[model samples]
Target: MSLELNINAAIKTAMLAKAEADLRALRAIKAAILHAKTAEGFSGELSEADETKLLQKLAKQRKDSLDIFRQQNREDLAAKEEEELVVIEKYLPKMMDEAELKAAIEAIIAQTGASSPADMGKVMGVATKQLAGKADGKAISGLVKELLAK
Candidate 1:
């Protein structure tokens, strides 16, 4: 099923289950999908990749909000954001652990013949493309920097 349809179904299920946090997250996803579908210059339906990107973006936003709330000592807000994040994360692919990420980056470096720190750009370009949705961009960039500086 399309992500949009799946999200709608999930929202209904959440509502029936009286899962307030899940219902909130699912509603947010539905709103984002609807906005993408109707955005100016957007064609008919959103591609699966686009849907995934949208969900990832939402998850990132929630994480950022949670971080800021924590920093500001807003425990209530941080807890709420964390709850939303958990719900959103259920749809994402399993994230790569540090070892797996390092291995993937190393392989990309080898494939691109990246040797010195000067070749960081080439390595980054390839690694980002291969690792998108599977790893956080900041984590990947930091790993690339550490590996290249060695």
Candidate 2:
């Protein structure tokens, strides 16, 4: 089933079960999807790739919000954001662990002949496309820097 359908069905299930956390997260996702459809310059066409990117973006946003909430000592808000983040993350591709990510980046560097940090842009361009949804940008960049420096 398409993710859109799953989101709608889950929303209904959440409502039926009176699952406040699930309901809130589902509603946020639905709203974001709707906004993406109507956003200016967007084609109103969300392919599987686009949807995956959307989910990743939402997860990142929730993580940022959760961070700020925790810093402010707002456990209640942080918990809510954490719950939503978990929901959003379930839809994203399984993230690559450090070992796997390092191996992949090593292969990419070898393929691209990235000998130094200066070639990071070239490596990153290809790596980002290759690793999209599977690895976070921060992790990729850090790994790339560490590998290239050596």
Candidate 3:
């Protein structure tokens, strides 16, 4: 089934269960999907990869908000952002763990012949394309720097 169908089912479940946080998150996702469909030059359809990207963006937004809320000592807002992040992440592809990410980046560096920090751009270009939603860019960049400096 498509993400829209899955979200719809989850919305029904959330509504039935009277889950406020879940319901709110589901509606936010639904709104994003609708917006993407109607956005100019979007062709009114989202491929699986596009859906994954959208979900990842939403998850990232929630994470940033959660951090800000925590820093501001707003536990209530932070809790809400955390709940939304959980819902958004349910639709994203599983992220690579550190070891797996390191191995993948190492292979990418070897492929691109990236020997030092000077070749970061070369390594990053390939790694970002290959990993896409599998890992965070910041994490990949940090690992690449650590590995290449050795």
lDDT of 1 at 53: 88
**Top-scoring candidate (TM-score):** 3
- Mind giving the per-residue lDDT tens digits that candidate 1 earns over 78-121? 99999999999998878999999999999998899888899999
lDDT of 2 by residue, 1-150 (tens): 778889999999999999999999999999888998899998856899989988998999999999999999999999999999988888888999999999999999999999999999999999999999899999999999999999
Q: TM-scores, in order shown?
A: 0.95, 0.95, 0.97
Per-model lDDT: 0.91, 0.93, 0.92
lDDT of 1: 0.91
* Per-residue lDDT value at 21 in model 2: 94
Could you give me the TM-score of model 3 versus the true structure? 0.97
Candidate 1 minimal-lDDT segment of 10 residues: 43-52
